[model samples]
Target: MKTMLFSILAALLLFVPNAAAHTYISETTPQDGSTVTENVQQVVLTFEGKIEEGSTFKVIAADGTAYTPQSITLVDGVLTGTFEPALPNETYTVKWDTISQDGHPLSGEFGFTVNAPVEEQVIEKEEESTEQEAAPSVESTQQANDEDAEKSTSPLLLVGGLLVIIIIVSIVALAKRKKA
Candidate 1:
């Protein structure tokens, strides 16, 4: 019986670290796989737990132009990175690396497209010009919105999966204890 209890405790100890090490993003500005209609001046990441001092993140434009944050601040579980001159209209990928409160290193990357709002151009029509300005199609907008919804739920799914694993482990341990 003692051996069985020890085995269960050891198994739980192994899983505990894995659970504690995950410091996932709880919220973000310019969310993953989203389309921003205005200039993005800053990126904010809210984590599930407090982060260390050395935690940092960067933004990379689709054309390989990397923009380092002008200032980064960490307050408890929230990390905010600000950029100067605003990010130009381009698809950007945010990559971040941080040390969680548990001292475990965590890193992740997510991409978003920026479509800054443009001022309407005033053109003097000469002899009834028929030129028309192009606009985004409805289908494309719908697709982008759908993608954003899918990405937003990803963190929730991760938490649900972890809960399921823990529940299964608990059930198994209880069964073993009963048998012993």
Candidate 2:
């Protein structure tokens, strides 16, 4: 009986650390092995648990251009790395390193492809020139002003409604007190 109890306790101790092991990447933007048609300005990694401050990631293009992140931030178990000038058409490999909450070092790598067509770039340039030449119409300006007014009034409307409710409740409470 003593030997059996000792074996069971040893086995339980071995499994406990594994169960509470380091956190891992639960989800990633531009998911691994995916082909995207749009510009990728940021990469986001969501971990199974909160990550430490030193966590970061890098992007390497197929042409061997290494794009370091302009900024890295962590919030609620999610790490985001933003890159300037967006990623062009290329197959990219993302390498990341992070420290888990348990003080263990963790790292991973994933690949994705960006393939934005050249024709869209030309069209976007043409649209920008045309929009620049066009002046804002009177009706559009009025609509924008109306939208701003609505946004500014929203909070005021909510506060007014709450004040009215409070006054009504106060009056009812005073009436009940006199009756009692």
State TM-scores per candidate: 0.59, 0.61
- Give the candidate number with the greatest TM-score: 2
For candidate 2, write residues 44-101 as lDDT tens digits.
Answer: 8878788899999999998999999889999987898876556778999999898889
lDDT of 1 by residue, 47-157 (tens): 877889999999999999999999999998888887755677899999988888888687777778878654411121221145432222211211123433454456666
For model 2, the superposed segments whose C-alpha errors exceed 4 Å read 1-17, 122-180
- Where does candidate 1 have its weakest 10-residue lDDT segment? 134-143
Instruction: Evaluate residue 67 in candidate 2 and report its C-alpha lDDT on the 0 to 100 scale.
Output: 95
After TM-score superposition, what is the CA distance of residue 35 in candidate 2 from its true location, in Å?
A: 0.2
**lDDT of candidate 2 at residue 160, scale 0 to 100:** 56
User: lDDT for each of the candidates?
Assistant: 0.69, 0.69
